[model samples]
Target: AQSVTQPDIHITVSEGASLELRCNYSYGATPYLFWYVQSPGQGLQLLLKYFSGDTLVQGIKGFEAEFKRSQSSFNLRKPSVHWSDAAEYFCAVGVRRDDKIIFGKGTRLHILP
Candidate 1:
């Protein structure tokens, strides 16, 4: 069985500050990893993924993550934050041969100007 856990349920950051969200997964084999961001009343958009090479992967909206095999972690990071970036972020694991993906409960990010 494969599963993902997001430690932080919610986070608040000031504008132009750095941000990081934690993620941990349990899988028998190397699984397809993904991070998605969803705005209120909107569908989820893929931020990034880790399927093969390069432990460090970059994604849209100036976001990046590092895949740590030993720690079973893939944490999201951004140098500076923006007010518009406020949204709910979800971490997901794609199981091989499985059409569906499992998503974390999500972390609601609040931005303060």
Candidate 2:
């Protein structure tokens, strides 16, 4: 079974400020982890993915995430955020072999000027 947990329901950050969103997952020994962002009424956009190799992976929009196997966590980070970056973020885990995908509850981001 694959599962993800996003503890933060909402997060507020000022424009140009740094942002970090936490994610934890429970899955097989080696699971495919991904981070996605979605705007209101829009579909989810892939932010980053961790399949193998690098523990730290970079994504679009100045965002990055590090996979910590010990903590079972993959936290997203941005050095500086823009107003347009405000959106709902979700953490997901997938099994390529089974074509199964599991998503988190999601965390809505609010930009405060």
lDDT of each: 0.94, 0.94
lDDT tens digits, residue span 1-113, model 2? 67899999999999999999999999877888999999999999999999999999999989999999999999999999999999999999997878987999999999998
Q: Model 2 — TM-score against the truth?
A: 0.96
Candidate 1 stretches greater than 4 Å from native: none
Q: What TM value does model 1 have?
A: 0.97
Best by lDDT: 2
lDDT of 1 by residue, 16-102 (tens): 999999999988888789999999999999999999999999999999999999999999999999999999999999988776688
Model 2 residue 64 CA deviation (Å) reads 0.4
| Predictions: Cα RMSD each | 0.7, 0.8
Worst 10 residues of 2 by lDDT: 93-102
Q: For residue 98, give model 2's deviation from the true position in Å.
A: 1.9
